[model samples]
Target: MNKWLQVSFVILTFALSGQAYTDDSKVSLPDDSIYHLDSEWVTQDEQTINIQSLSGKQQMVSLIYTHCMHTCPTIVATMQNIEKKLPQDVLDNTEFVLVSLTPASDTAKVLKDFAEKRKLNQDRWTLLTGDPQDIRSLAMALNIRYKKSDDNEVAHSNVFTLLDEQGRIVFQEVGDINKVDETVARIVSQ
Candidate 1:
């Protein structure tokens, strides 16, 4: 009877452990993950990269145009402020992505120049430009609305999108560019 009890306990332990391992191995991204979008982008260095290529890292994304005289600069400054407040570890794991609304004018060289003028960190920041249709598709996926005016300036709303390591949008802040403390707290806690 004692030997039989020992064997049963061993079998039960093995069965439970096997089930747990299977569950852990089957972890998957949610259906609505933004990584599912099939948008390709050209980096400031002229390298072409797909949105999924940004997977495995947390990302903060914004839409902007280089020619804007008002809101774009403020948006960039807000991003810079957020970066400054993040802890070193969080900063290391995060990527700041700026997608150009004026893809026709904001070529790789233009994007690179804008980054340099702003003194954005080359390693942590990525500025992208691509086909106008592709850019519009990405904007739609993120729910960002924008349109070019008769004067060629982009009329758009201000939104900062925060994506998790899997590219799922975990948080988003609209308007009030300076109200980022909650966003910072979310990043730190995650």
Candidate 2:
């Protein structure tokens, strides 16, 4: 009876601790935080989440569509390379976001297939597609520009943005991705 009572007490304590940790007692976000945007996004695995849900960890974000035959692939490769250069602790706490510039075509299923083919680590990488307007809003917020051509191709800016836990921009790399690893490590260490 004593052992059973102790075990029950331990379980209840853990349950309460978890609930408290997840409670809605978060501090208010600043005016410029990207998380303040009311946009709904679907992940590669078809889970429906939002920008705010991505708030806790540092976010390294890029814009790409899976079907692109040009710089988009390079962008993905660059993100993977950045992941390799991070220290284990920073890598574990950081999340990579790839937002589809062609959201009208890059459905959740398509994103999932792309992720599988590329062997992207689902635990650390998020491939997202959402309504076109939402994608545009996020792109504008991050200072990434895009225009769709008649050939079904998108001419887009090559920008990689880093957002801190509260969704404020820590750094943004434009065109040249070679510096991301070093910048990320330095900012995170500081």
Candidate 3:
């Protein structure tokens, strides 16, 4: 075989393999992934980010109102505990997302205050508030039911949902924080 021909064949094979690898890396999300929701949210820092922007990391998602006097605080505490239990590597690749059920009242400033009061790690914790309809749509997609009570509190179901790196719900626990170990296991396995 001629030297030039051999060299050219090697280069061509490498290029083709590179192209194949690139194509394989672009995996499509599942049809039911939360990234399919076109909702816009404002972070505690007042930055506008779309729901799909959170697609690349594992996420622990919950719906809450900053002003709630009961279940909301419990939910936040439970999430914090879960964060503490996660392995550092899993924690590094995970985000804890709290979406406001009362978007009208849970402004960016309010969310910021709530985050500060709870001593949440702002880097890993995202508190979001957006259009009421968008919030409602997100809650519905997560199967979280909630309503405003006469006393001005949000009466919501207690639940914690774990979304895989691709934004598909991998595991969800309804009611108390008893499933923290299971949630951590799922995240680590992912």
The TM-scores, one per candidate, come to: 0.81, 0.81, 0.81
**Distance from true position, residue 147, model 3, in Å?**
1.3
Predict model 2's lDDT versus the native. Answer: 0.84
Off by over 4 Å in 1: 1-29, 175-177
lDDT of 3 at 166: 78
Clashing pairs in 1: none
Alpha carbon lDDT of each predicted model = 0.85, 0.84, 0.85
Once model 1 is optimally superposed onto the true structure by TM-score, how far is the C-alpha of residue 20 displaced, in angstroms? 28
Candidate 3 clash figure, as a count: 0
The parts of candidate 2 lying over 4 Å away from their true place are 1-27, 175-177
lDDT of 3 by residue, 1-190 (tens): 8999998898899888875333222247677887777678999999999888898888999999998887888888888988999999889889999999888789999999999999999999999999988988888888888888676688788987888887888877753678667666766787
Can you write out model 1's per-residue Cα lDDT over 28-121, one digit (the tens) per residue? 6566777666578999999999888887889999999999998889888888888999999899899999999998889999999999999999
Expressed as tens digits, the lDDT of each residue in 124-172 for candidate 2 is 9999999989999998999889999877789998778889888888888
Q: With candidate 1 superimposed using the best TM-score fit, by how many Å does residue 156's alpha carbon deviate from the native?
A: 0.8
Residue pairs with backbone overlap in model 3 = none
